[model samples]
Target: MRASRFFALRERGTDARTEALGGLATFLTMSYIVFVNPAILSSAGLPFDAVAVATALAAGGFTIIMGLTTNLPFALASGLGINAVVAFDIILGRKVSPDVGMACIVLEGLLAVVLVLAGMREAVVRAVPTSLKLAIGVGIGLFIALVGLRDGGIVVNDPSTGIALGDLSTGPALIALAGILVALGCAAANVRGAILIGIATSTVLGLVFGVLDGPSAVARWPTSGDFSTIGDGLAPGALRDALTWALVPIIFSLFMTDFFDTVGTAYAVTSAGGLLDERGEIPKVRNLLLVDSAAAAGGGAMGVSSVTTYVESGAGVAEGARTGLASVVTGLLFALTIFFVPLIAVVGQGVTVGKDTTLHPAIAPALVMVGYLMIQLVREIEWDRPEDAVPAFLTIAGIPLTFSISAGIGLGVFGYVVTMIARGRVREIHPIMWMLVPMFVAFFASNWLSAHVF
Candidate 1:
């Protein structure tokens, strides 16, 4: 009764046993993040153990908060595309320190919180056309798939062609290919946690082929050094460095992704769970947004990345989880993963085939699999209208080809405005969209502005 009172389980037409099963289902569907997040973030030069710990802490803590505050079955974790931006785009591409890159995430999260408080988050979302928003997800999916291919050694840099097919005969490549097949097979069979299962299978193949080293320890309590990334974004000078003119658009880009992602995930998951209000909107949306916004900042402060609601919560909903009790269960599972750091380390470690070529056979397939999942949004875009199609195409191609999510979004925005003006539909463009034009122009010329104007 106390549990029912706290989570309003009976009102939601759910019981404790159903909530527990739903929580387990959701956790199984998403537990791959525990291995994948650290694998991705560690490439940015963050400590592997630290990121692993931070990732679990953020996911567990935020998901529990989401359950308690909003009484929804939504779960939170370090977002996939957002982490890629923080790791590759901000830190490696821009050549900024990890602290500065993470500080950008913090700023973006805080800005989102401000926008939500001011009731302007929806305004910003409406400013961008639906086609462009959908295209952003598709573009990022290609970008992620590209990264996965490169990491798995199925694709490699070429002297003449820029990139070419890699040596599939290699152990890592073979394992990756096999892993992808296994994942796809499982998915086709409606397997739960297919991606996680693929990673495990690939890791085993890697071990058998001697391409991966086994874990030194099975489990242990993490030490202080394992959490050194905590609060790194707030260290002196990090936030200052992140606030530069050149980085502002990058932060805005992150905010846009996080903002739209939460809205979309919340709507989809709640709708599936029959948890929508009479108006067909998410119940307690403000509370949900607040928790998601705070999680983004919390993830950055913990040195992971932006944390957001996962669409995979639908898996729990499918299992009869209609209340936040399921979320609390998911959070507890994530918390339990902290002790299995050694097993995580084994799968996350990269295998070097050459002086410059490192392969992640165990983890690469999951990236490719996730990309496949995200890319499914492509069907929602209308291709017949050139105005929408052209901009969407530019965005879809720009992200993976140019290696910049923001650049792709800017291209799409610029093209959308230009095409609308060409069609004499200028008045249809939102004032916020108009504001974005100059900002994107500035973003495109940021290096020049930083050099001459600033």
Candidate 2:
């Protein structure tokens, strides 16, 4: 009896060890996005450091909520779409006050809350066809891969020259790219902590090449001196005019992007993890939606413009994590990094000339992934049935070209509807799809009206 007890105890210990390792792996996988996202957003004049800290906390809280409510392993954060809107459109283009932006964020969160309580979340997911979900997953993968490639210097911007080779012959940039590529290759080959390894290697190479020298490299943690006025710079009343005009577009972009991004990520990660049940559905999806909504709401309170689920979390999900334990671990690690924001910001600035410079390494990876996914999509679609393939093909290609994911999706949906009508399959299409026609008309008409009216 004592011998049997000893064996049981040992088994329990082994299980615990396994759980711990799984959690740690998840945290490591997500850390890259968590760290880099804020830095990128901040370069556009938003309070990146504070937003980073808040996002981490919000993510942790939401993760805990999901675990308690649904028992499904998932985490949340400011989404890529929101980050782009905040960086490019709101901060730079419209010059809206960050305070007003935060207010809009809060409203979006409230809308998400309503969405969850109304059971719309699950209903929409259920309503979406599998083919669209697949396209979304592939699209997100391509999007993120493009982001990585651009940051890594594999792609560059030139209006006159168009797409061409970047300055890869340089020391630091070349070293960083090589290091990241080597690390990614290792990860693909089953090496653990691939991203961290890549970052460290690049950092070292950066130092050796004198790219990360001077005061920029030596700045202390939680660097708040330069941003002392951030908290006090609220021009809420002054922002109303701008906010009024921009609100519709901002909200529309945020909702469309976040909704699809979350859906696509959930589908992709669940598929990769082999977590889909016999019915090809994720279990306890309601709880995941709730967690996501709550995180967005929390992000608004913390002054970040938009918070949503991360599609890149698929990287962790692909690595064998099966429980919310992974999310919890990731959240905790992000919380700890709050103290090092200054150091990170400083280091980030030192290595990359500006925020755009930091984006060089990510560009190549993005292109490669997009190319790969497009190939896969072409193979999967029923090309002989041009009615189906043409629409899907357009959706896949239109996103990057149009510079708007929603517009791309909108075009795809419109194409699908037109094709269905042409093929005499109109009855098979959902009634909600009819809504697309008017939306398309309205969207383009508004653009035309704006050009002429203004």
Candidate 3:
């Protein structure tokens, strides 16, 4: 089959332009990782440029693999939470070396690949309630919006008020507001590439208004030798020292977090893309899972943290991404960052705003709009049933509040099990639920586990 026929672009009513635009939307929303991953990892003695280069390759390469093999419009990259855990809790806090952290990532990733090849993921998907699955999708949408608002200076953290409206009087805030209006209007008009066009408009407006300055270099190559320090560069016996019984909980926690986090993201984004089967389960799931494991292993080899799926891919799905072509477009865009650093910086980089002049601009509108689109999934929940409504609400409400996808999933599972058993529906629980509930309990008690076991 020709690649286009295999992707069913004509059958699904999507053309190359739509797929390209969807991919661009997904890339723009998630590209912040290129800047963020390096900044967080460099604190633990890694080189900034080296981490930056690795981040781009990890995201682009593995995401392209996802696009080609599974044809789902999902992207994978070094995860946000796991990076901090590796940097702060493992390396810096425990006095473990960075090289050992990479080793741990490789081991953890190997476990994930093993699970996939062994065909053990089916029950894990079946364990999640349908209402909660939709909630997961909706929750990720809201989470992406919240992140964009905070990043764009449209919403600021207020110690007294929790989250207050940012000073819209500033330039970046104004740009965000303008971008939101323009993007919304374009979407309403059923325009192609509305999200990408909105972002481009905002960047051009920023430059014209002196809000965002251009980068010094137009097109520069990465000048770092970071790839030289990958999985094999352990600190003599550091890998062994880091792998004692005490490290079990820590590694387990990493595995649990990486495992479920990817599950939630993959479920949420694919659902938004209308890729779920009749039972709300992903088709060819085992094959899809391989890309995630490959991404994590590749990230480890590149000296980064555990790689996982980004919920921001929901932004593209909301904009009408229905196939892997979107993922290919997204990956190619990320790869271009290596040479087009300056161009990406102008849009993806933060624009100075607010009193301290520290906020990113130009991308918040697309996020908020996509979030609005995801909210419709809430209606799909079987709200008439208390068992469904309660857990679904917990998941939808808790995701943005907790700032963690896995946290919301845990709470929803807890709510569902409690409600089901309380309602005398104990027999309704899947066997996998018993396994998941205890794992969730362990995840919630992770800090205590660390203090006692580790």
Candidate 4:
């Protein structure tokens, strides 16, 4: 049989099975975040159970939106970094209320919706260079790896002790680290369900060795309470606070980070899943942005913080999820999990370390790998002619170090302008790109002044 004909037959033979497997895999991979983030935020004083229900509902709604509108094979959920930012940085670090923090998230969602409706997202995206997108992707990867390492107990903070080895020699931490490593290795080797398999195995081993203990360790899966109380903790006054000066930085941060993260994630996952065409555009960008915006808004109403696209959706795509059907399936599963919150909670609490102590050891290695990969990619760009290389490198490396994606993107845009001017190729660049420079500078300077002056 001809190759196309043979593949067609094969696709027909396994389409239903593949899709079912894809949906299940997607659920397993994301359920942890769906369950854990709310718990974490709630423990920090937000309504724990309310956040849980809201997260699931918002995620399901948005995933369905993405599937129906975009026809792209991807899933949506609460973002990992954004949640940490909301819970730790905005809420605790700045001493802001969770209500106010969520308000900012709502504002961002509104802004995103406006951008999508105005057709501005596509324009803004086109204005950004492809190299910059890649840089953002690599930077996020490094940042994520760093977070994992810190979480897994592989890295420790010691000022007086001065960088001593962490307790990798200990049992619970060691086992978790080992399990993560094995799963990551398997993922690299193209193993299916790598993350789910890793977490499950680690949890079981933790239970077996007494590493897993107590009720707070495992996450409650979902329950009737999870579904029935979606909008339990909203504070209208908090929304008003978000409308004030306190929300300015939060809004900017949310928009910049979510925009780049979503873009980079789509690119990486689509490529991995063989979904992108020759030009690297995921079809229906407009629809994707709309769903993302809607999801964030939904999350806000449901009493959670921000909801954005999941990079882990790549896992689903890798498993051969090809259409909205996959996302719909994923959404339904999330809705169904409402009844199993107790099981999720037990699992989350039982097999994990104390919230203060739980760590992921692979973070350092992952960061190192991402950094190396980024450097390698940057070097391949022709920098020997200073005009070609300096800006790109600055853009690539500056994000994580500065802890601001907008700053990094701004630097890249600024470099592009200077390079164009020096090379006498100024006309090729757009006026709007130059506009970003002053905006970024103003934002950064204001933030600096706020920190120092206030």
Candidate 5:
């Protein structure tokens, strides 16, 4: 098949229709980023339209590259946690200019590129234990789940209590619950596209039940992006401004967050796709990593935050995508979104309420279901070994609790190493593992100090 030769679908055990559906599924699951990433970055004084354009271009362009070059099913885009860091910590917290913040992101991306090109990235990826990798996948699953729940209005914040059940009487909350039920029902019935179907159904119900206010019209082209601040970030003056002695910790924090967030997303999505080889390594991993780092660097140049692999690609993998064709479809959808921004803006606005929007409960169901699927990795872990199980559990728990992928890995790795040392099995640890302990501690300490002292 022409498709078979291009994406090797036959060899990988998928067909054209299945891969196409998978791509559509993945796009539906993740297209929210087009709006969300721009919204978050705008808080840091970046232009919303420009960030939106850059986000779409970076996501679409590099995801296509990932498909074509690596022939893998992974997709890349502006990351969630990193955007918060760029906005809150790098820009707002440090009182840095937006350009300087972009400088930090650019430097972080360039460092990733150097590491990948030098094979240091692969070395680090290989050094991580399999159990911990699976744990990262599960951890990210719950993190996104928490996000989905918040967005769906199933969960809400209480000034009295940290978080509590949302108001059930609200139209959005009820629609979210209905959407969740539809998705869960479809999955239980073994229906293909169950998640997508649920999203569509919930959207229609949201419209009919007065839960969502409809747009007057659905489609229009997006505004062109402003690349005015693109490469200005890494200029000599900008670097000098960004690199105070006190900010060493800030830079390291950026690098660490970008590095492991990609690692976690890549691990989770690839594992979901069954793209791992017998050794539990994603094939063409070096290519994938290079493409990922290149995407981050390119996003910086294109005027956005860090771009990394999207974990929502698991939606595609769950739908039977086993080749790059799915990624191609996803990239194409992102490209088309440039013209359909008006339509997406209407439908995907979710349920906005006083700056507290519900996860367009329409799509939140997909994430909840995907998280359920990814969490199944827990069963594959060797539970009897305390050294392995403890670290694994910590990693899994930490991802959601800390709301940072790198922090979870750091916690898990630290726990693993300390447990081994206590048990007199320290010799088994990788040398790089030793290097990581202090790095993780530094990331935590730096953030704490910045929050408490400075």
Candidate 6:
């Protein structure tokens, strides 16, 4: 068959029907991004509808690219952690415009590709401790949960203490809590599409409680206006602005997150499918990395955030998918969602909770569920060893507390280097890890330097 010949289905031992089923499964598992992404980006002043459009477009287009180029089942989308960095750290915290924030992602993506081509990843990958890499994902998971809580109106800024529990009595908070419970129930039942299911349930409850407005239309054809945010990162001066000295560490942090996440996701997903080669490495992994890296830049260029391969692709692989055909099916599903942006906006649209706080009661459940899922990485760290324990603790705590992924990473690096020296392992530290110490210092003090020196 043409399909079998094109995707090597026969060699991979997966039929076209099986591949289709796998792709459908994958799409169902990770499709929650269509609603959640716009809700997060809109917090940084981007339009909700436009960002929703961009998210679907970038996810669909790049996922297809991944399938075509690498012949892998990995799916791509706006990454959750990287989106937080763009929305909260760079855009809001550093006072840079949204376009400039995305420009940083574009640069990070391009740099990642260059590093891959130059074969310079060995030293950089080996330099960081395994515990730290694991902790970054765990910390970002906590950070995402915190954002979910705030968005759900389950947590609020306290004048006396930094944060306090919100009034669970409110409609939005109650709806969010209900949604979270539903998600947990679904997960416990081993249901596929638990996150998306939770979001749908929450939206229904929000509508019932009058906490969310209904959509004006169910579906509509996308227009040029719907894609207005495309290429915003490449606007004149945006790239140049992202090249400043102050943003050096920020970009580096983004690159690290993008790079490490792909490495981990690729390994785990491929391993699950029994696809690793004799050396215990993924086949054509370089192509996988290349497509993943380009997706990051493509996402930024499309005015979303950095896109990366999703572990959710494992859903497809588990269902007998062994080639890119499954990815093509998943990508097509994502593209079809663009027409339903109006329905999606109903969930993305938030409720006004206070004078200034807008609560996204419908979308909060998915974010909370995703955070819970990511936090599972915490168990992999060897907690008894102080050298690893301290840095991992700092990283896991710093991200949500400081509300800065990069700052949390900086703290972890500092703790790692300090602990290594104190443990008499000074000479064992990789030169690259040592180099990161001063860079993180500059990152931590960039604001001060900008005000006084630079």
Q: What TM-score quantifies how close candidate 2 is to the native fold?
A: 0.81
Query: What TM-score would you give candidate 6 relative to the actual structure?
Result: 0.92
lDDT of 1 by residue, 184-232 (tens): 8998898888888888889999998898898999999999988999999
The better candidate by lDDT, 2 or 6, is 6
After TM-score superposition, the amount by which residue 218's alpha carbon in candidate 2 deviates from its true location, in angstroms, is 9.7
Q: Which whole-number lDDT from 0 to 100 does residue 188 have in model 2? A: 68
What is the lDDT, from 0 to 100, of the residue 9 in candidate 2?
A: 23
Report the Cα lDDT for candidate 3.
0.75
RMSD of 1: 2.4
lDDT of 2 by residue, 1-454 (tens): 4522422324323233443455566666555545555655675765656666655655666655654565444666666546656666666676766666656566566677788789986777876655665565455555555555556665667788765556888654585576667676766687776666666566566666666542343334555543332322234563344346436556555666677667766776676667787898977787777677766656656655456665445555555556555555566766676666655553344246456555423222223433343334344456677566766666767666665677667777777888888889989887656765676565545556455553
lDDT string, candidate 4, 141-203, tens digits: 555545555555665657886434567877655765776776667667877656656666666
Ten contiguous residues minimizing lDDT sum, candidate 3: 226-235
In model 3, the clashing pairs are none
Compared with the true structure, what per-residue lDDT tens digits does model 3 show for residues 198-268?
67777788888998887677777766464555554244465576577666656666676677667766776
Q: What TM-scores do the predictions have?
A: 0.92, 0.81, 0.77, 0.81, 0.83, 0.92
lDDT of 6 at 240: 94
Distance from true position, residue 300, model 4, in Å? 2.6
TM-score of 4: 0.81
Where does model 5 exceed 4 Å of error?
A: 1-22, 39-50, 87-101, 194-211, 225-241, 245-250, 265-280, 315-320, 350-370, 447-454
Please give the TM-score that candidate 3 achieves against the real structure. Answer: 0.77
* Cα lDDT, model 5, residue 427: 91
lDDT, each prediction: 0.86, 0.59, 0.75, 0.64, 0.76, 0.86
lDDT of 6 by residue, 1-454 (tens): 8878989998998899999999999898888888989988898998888899899989998998899888889899999878978987789889999999999999999998887777666446546787887787788778878888888989999999989999999999998889889998998898877888888888998888788888899999988888988998988799999999888778888987788777756766787798988976678877887788888888888889999988789889988899999999999999999999899999988787668787788888888887887787788789999888999999899988988777887899899989999999999888888888888887788779777776
Q: What is the lDDT of residue 141 in candidate 5?
A: 71
